[model samples]
Target: MSIKIKDFWKAGVVCICVLMLSSCDKWVNDTELPDNTIDESQLNSIAMLGRIEKGAYIPGPVIAGVWRAGATSAADLLVASGAISDEIVPTAVPNSPFYKELDEDKLTPDNTSLFSVWSNIQNYRARAEDAILNAGSLAPADEDGVKVKQAALVNARLHAGYAWMLLADYFSVTNTSHSIYADHKELSHQEAYGKAKAYWEQAIPTASDAEKRLLHSLLAKMGIHTGNYSLAVQYINQSFGASENFSFLNTVGTVSNGFFNALNVNSRDAAVDPTLVVALKTTADKARNPVVKAAKGHWSLTLLKERDPLVVSDYEEMQLIRAELIIRGLLTGNATDLVNSVVVKYDATGLSNFPAGPALTLNDIVSIRRIFLSWRGTRLIDLRRFNIDGDLIPGFTQRKWQWIGVPEIETQK
Candidate 1:
């Protein structure tokens, strides 16, 4: 694509947005940036693309902040693992039981969590769309620039579309046609899902090898959930060889250089401390704001890995896709495609575990997702989308949470 200087200036000015339901029209379009030296070539620069993509994951906590009540969203797993359950909000006083019950679906929406992850996803999607738009407006000419731009464009769309999908599937509400730029009309449940799939279709072709694999796996979710077995298989094939390893951070003992310390804006994400949890729970009666100081480390170690392996893209994801297609009656492809992917190719002696068969199951797929995504901020959407086993979430679904009781002030006894 040819890039006129004016177009380059425009691209740099307005940040991209992804939420179609509530699209953002940036003000920068009216006010140009002071540094107008961006070129189409920058899109391909690893240095450039890396910097831009960092924005996507960094600000995610802004949305998570609300989800965890007053605590950071980082507490998501810990809450789910059930460590901080008794760190009662002093406000939880008499109403806490009924209200808490309601929040967890043990009660109802009459008991809503502090925030709607469903709605927050829209904001996230809009942010992603903005990034894609930036990619589109780039006048990238170099080979590397082309690759990075295309990858950015595809991932940007993927993030936006997935956000919308999460919103529709998880929440009690559903409105997909809300707008890519502005509200057009309210879309039904299926319509919104279709919109998400359509967006995924358009963007999938442009993804990098790794991204393609990730999308391929994700497409299976959207398609299978919707009964489009064949479409799911096709997308899965498109994503072959995407990931081959999975790894986790080994940060607990090395706190000063750990992942928690790196991302903990509040300096509160320490390793699981049983004593701290009990201490905070007991002090609740004397506390002010009780939500922030409750459980310190119940779920933090749920699946804590000493060292996460880099699970790269492999044919295994494709095999599972094929298998699901067969189960759904959409494809006649040999199940070997699926079977071979999971067959261990190497043993302790480093020989092929060869010709493995039917070892994978639906449970296996879920396990893979958990290992792969870990605490990468992908679970909240899934948890909202009918919970772990495709069971409808009870109206009283209490999302994972953390409560840091507001510290007490000294008083003369």
Candidate 2:
């Protein structure tokens, strides 16, 4: 795969990383220093390790067409998954067949979107593992290099663990069927969460300030996925300052933030699912008012122009998590007040296009999350996690982890 960071690849420079071996023979051959092998001396140096780390992040598009997916291109996955829930609806249903399948919740094993997600996640996991294990083998030449190499390894492990969590949370697979490692081991959800937590724990002590903040945010997410709300709240508290929000960057040729291009530019899908407006209309709450405007018979989400950065974690999510904890009596606060504060803040700042209504509750919290996290992804997961799959919305379907379609590469096993 080629990575283009603002036309640098056009300058004839190739970014290459030693990804996990495809075969046991190749794995063994790596130790013998074959002709194609990365130089051992280079691998031992901190400079080369830094390059490998950057290579892992280069957005390599994976699933094409309707099921666009990539290693780093999670925004695409957001849009695709949004179709499965009542968060996003397709504009051209007849032309875009995947939208119909996603809308109806009829996913086959060979579904292109599922296959793309499965393949890309495994590759990412392998790449991260390669970096972590290889980096462990070398000692840095200087103290600064040692810190840099350690940070890279920490980030690599975090990425690998996250891939495992995504696989476990989003797909149903057996150890023998969906193995990504040479050993052919597939982890259960609990096992995946365990691995993710371990990686975060390993990185925390040595991580730099910014890296540590990211680790905390990710750990909080893992906690939410694993049904450990208390842990999630604890981690979110340590994540960052109340005002801080985090985003990952994307470039034009190298990384097209696929959410904007596919939906707005290509005109392939509708901006916002119309259900949010419909739900409020029927709720009979006089105080309820959300800020979705109709354009040409559909909601106009024209704010996110092309080239907008995607938020990785934000204060809205952190507070929502806390609000849920408060509602459950696990935390000490008025859940309504906490949720309304966030909602009012979003509306006051005009940061969120969706305006907050009066006298909010837990349901409002969920609604605000759907609005705030619209293309940020988490719609289907929230539905599944809350066990309200077929509720709330009229035609909602239960989204659950699915077994992967047999890939061509798996046949080699």
Candidate 3:
């Protein structure tokens, strides 16, 4: 009986096929609906716009179950930059060839880890652009929708500006040619910075009050980086109040904090530089420089947690920028008082102000930034800016590289 039932089902399928063949023209004439597709028009919803905005910050699975570059690129930058500079040192560990490459300053264009960071930075910019476009295309029907659309556009622009700024800061330019994207078009470092400045300037009009202040701080930082001191001063005046202690952080979500995972949590691919540890031990700014010994007995920082936000810009950084300008004769102020103010706020209670003595040299500002801005992804730039090389600290080796080389993939035609 079971066999008979199977035969009956097979016969029924054959009959249906024969009937469809007999009416093939009619069947073919009937319209076929779209299968498993979503049109661009469908993405105009507020929820979709919010998601596009979030994508600007979060890493997407670019490599299909193999790697998530965008999520960890910033962390990679921190580790590589710190190891090359004086902030940290690489440890002997499994699956850490990239760390060794950066630590030894033997980077090649083929370095996949560094390439991932490069690609992800570009990805962030692309995603931000997408958010801006999508937000502009959307028409808000209510106040809530308007807020969401504006937030998406403003955040997108801010993040895009920062992405461009990072590219200009960390990557090298050769004879005014720096390949930035898959398209193989080359841009000089200054051109890259100019792009960042444009995005920031565009964002100011629609930004919320707090966001405006943040944008001003970012513009000031860009100005300082590009040697536009007058512009830096103008934005610094609008960025933060002296007592604000304001900081703009890239909030972590779904992705873990890169520095914590690399240096302290998952693997000890790097540890706080021994020189920094010794420096911290004698200094009263322990509050600002928290440290703990790793499993290998090397020091690691506790400045970040698994999901804590990464510092983007801050009041202290602005103050330091001003202090640098003062030392360079571009600004008028007591650089020591500016530096001392930060020291007093962060220094352990009852520690005297940054020794009131000789005028603060650029090197002194570098030293202060080395301590206060530890693990903030600025050390390498500082080293480059000050032309610091030939043994950063006692027993440390001479510096080998100034900026990370452009990834090989970008240079390919």
Candidate 4:
């Protein structure tokens, strides 16, 4: 059989078995499940487990109703968060009313956008949790295939932890209870952060070099938020030797990058803040500016073509974290040298026309960070952090978020 057919056949078989075994519900509806469901006994093979892992990264149809591929991944959530924070603006009404609400900072319980974000976040979390929970339960076909289980467990934990962190970061009202089979109660933001930290820490031991780097970056943010600058610094130091940029693969069948989709394909929304685009252009910051375009009076991003990769975390973020720590006196380093190092490095890496001779201020670190991490969804948090520290950007708008409580869908339990 062709690879496509083979993949389809395997996915179909796995879906049937998983649904029957896991108690299909709202996300994985039983009525829609394939009739040719396989028996649970057939899942012991390593090949079948590999198929399950592959399916975990595939966009929904298994869990969430919409098959957004990668759009609903981190970038999409970033879009929602950006929209809520004034980093993105609405030109036309979005399909999801919740996004409109987010743009207005007035989300309601019944908003579909809220449910979509909540459901997608919870669905990813459930899949990750399932992989971790089932890691030891499944019997490998071969006696010495222990590596497969460990790999799967580590991958699942990494995704689960990050998903949990995303939930804590974006969702005002958090839910720790996720699973189609059982109901879970809601968690406060602090409780949610605890869950995120636990999963991240659990995954760190067996994570690959690159995965460990990504986790360190995330844990740094966690530490900073929890007022443990020491822990944040330690995590950054451990993973600082190399630049590990975690990007969302925007291949065909996997969704396109969210920014490109929303601003270019959808055209309903664009970058609202002109100053952001202006800064990138004037400062010779080619890394962020060229991707921004203006047409018909709408400013949209063209960073990724159809399948261009979207960077989620990288060296730039690591440097910013280090810079922030230095500014706060958490890490022992000259803040100016650290910030200048970032400038010098970026200049060396194709920013030849970098405006020269300005000593790096703490605001410069934050501003450079803003330019480098633009459209990746870290803008709002950076603004918030800096604003809290009285390092306000001259023309930045501070968005106020009102938490939308747990939706009725989850409350049905």
Q: Report the number of the highest-lDDT candidate.
A: 3
lDDT of 1: 0.38
Ranked by TM-score, the better of candidates 2 and 4 is 4
**Model 2 over residues 235-264: C-alpha lDDT tens digits?**
877775567665545643455555655455
- Window of ten residues with lowest summed lDDT in model 4: 58-67
What TM-score would you give candidate 3 relative to the actual structure? Answer: 0.78
Write the residue-wise lDDT of candidate 4 on 127-217 in tens digits: 5665565565766665334556656666666676777677666665322332221125556666777777888888888776766877887
lDDT of each: 0.38, 0.54, 0.64, 0.57
- Please, what's the RMSD in Å of model 2? 8.6
Model 3, 1-413: lDDT tens digits are: 11132233233323333332343333223234333222333333455444223333221111110112234555556656777777777775637667666667777778777767776666555555555676788788876667677766777677667767777777773313543442345677777888888988898998867778889988887787676888898888788665443223334235676677667734657777777777664345567778887676777778777776555557888888889989989889989888877777765463646767889998888788888877777877777666666245422234445667777666655
TM-score per candidate, in order? 0.47, 0.73, 0.78, 0.75
Worst lDDT run of 10 residues, candidate 2, spans 58-67
Q: CA shift at 405, candidate 3, in angstroms?
A: 1.9
On TM-score, the candidate that comes out on top is 3
When 1 and 4 are scored with lDDT, the better candidate is 4
* Model 1 quality (TM-score): 0.47
Q: In model 4, what is the error at residue 112, expressed in angstroms? A: 1.5
